[model samples]
Structures are given as structure tokens and as C-alpha cells.
Target: MAAMPPMDDELKALQWRAWHRGTREADLMIGGFFDAHREQWGSQERDWFSGLLQEQDVDIMAWAIGAAEPPARFQGPMMQAMQRLDYLKAPK
Candidate 1:
């Protein structure tokens, strides 16, 4: 296969991170979110997701599911969308 462009390469890395979070639940939540929304993301959204991927899976999950409050930086439309949890799909 041909190599991806630089931006595509970066997105692929982010996608890998989202889908390989060391647990089925986290993979589904984070990866599903990525798959559902990535096509529309501009640089700002991608940067937000990149920062989020650096955080612990438990903290990300907790913030997404309302188990704990997110930091001020993470409190915004993106987190709100994650909490909605409408994007997750079961693997076939």
C-alpha cells in the first residue's frame, strides 16, 4: 500500500491509540468516538483528542461517563459529546 500523507499518518496513530487502550470497554468507547467523529474534526479537535489520549483510560472513562468531573480544560462540547455515549457500536 502507498504511504499515508503526514496528517493522515498522525490520524492513524491517534486511531491506533484510541482502539488499543488495554481494555475492551476503553477501546470501544474511545475508538468508537474516534470513528464516529474523526471525519469532521479539524486541527483543534484532533489536538484535543491527542491530549485526551495521553490521559489514563480510567480517567478518560470516568470523565466520559460522569463518574468524575473532568478538568477545566476538558470541560467543553467534546466532553459533552463523549458523555452522550451515542457513538459506541459492538464489534461484529
Candidate 2:
């Protein structure tokens, strides 16, 4: 397999995507999750999150908030963490 890009560069790209989801709410929910949990992630977690960033923001938000069930691909620990919704800070 080819070498992976430097994680810092990859993570910077992910950060931009997470925080620019076209609406403030999506930005907060997605970006906040990224910020809060990213340090703990390994390759599998990063891959999952990278795939998630490709999903519709409304779908992602719904999954995060428990209003809708995530597809099998998105279920499991990562989604569980997102559902907790504790990472978001109220706007000051």
C-alpha cells in the first residue's frame, strides 16, 4: 500500500470540512465532535469520520441527535459518541 499522508495535513482538511457544512448548526455538531474526540482516534476512526463528512449534513445531524437511526455503516462507538452531543458549546 502507498504511504499515508501526514496526519496533520489530513486532519486539517477534515477540520475544514467539519466546520463548513453550510449551516451553523451542522458546523457546530460535526466540528465540535471532530475537535472533542479527534485526538483519541486511530486510522479506523479517522476513516469512519472521513466517510461521515461525505454525508448530508441534515442526515448527519439527525443521526447525531437521535432523531433518526444511522445506517449500518455509521452505527457503533463513533455514532454513540456523537449521539451524546456533549461536545457542543452554547454560542457566547
Please name the candidate that would achieve the greatest lDDT relative to the true structure: 2
* Candidate 1 stretches greater than 4 Å from native: 1-7, 90-92
Q: Summarize candidate 1's per-residue lDDT along 1-92 as a digit string, tens digits.
A: 56533448889999999999999999999999998788778999999999999999999999999999999989899999999999987568
What C-alpha lDDT values do all the predictions have? Answer: 0.92, 0.93
lDDT of the structure predicted as candidate 1 = 0.92
Q: Please give, for residues 1-92, the per-residue lDDT of candidate 2 as tens digits.
A: 56444458889899899999999999999999998888888889999999999999999999998999999999999999999999999878
Q: Model 2: runs farther than 4 Å from truth?
A: 1-7
- Residue 60 of candidate 1: its Cα lDDT? 99
How does model 2 score by TM-score? Answer: 0.90
- TM-score for candidate 1, residues paired by index: 0.88
lDDT of 2 at 77: 99
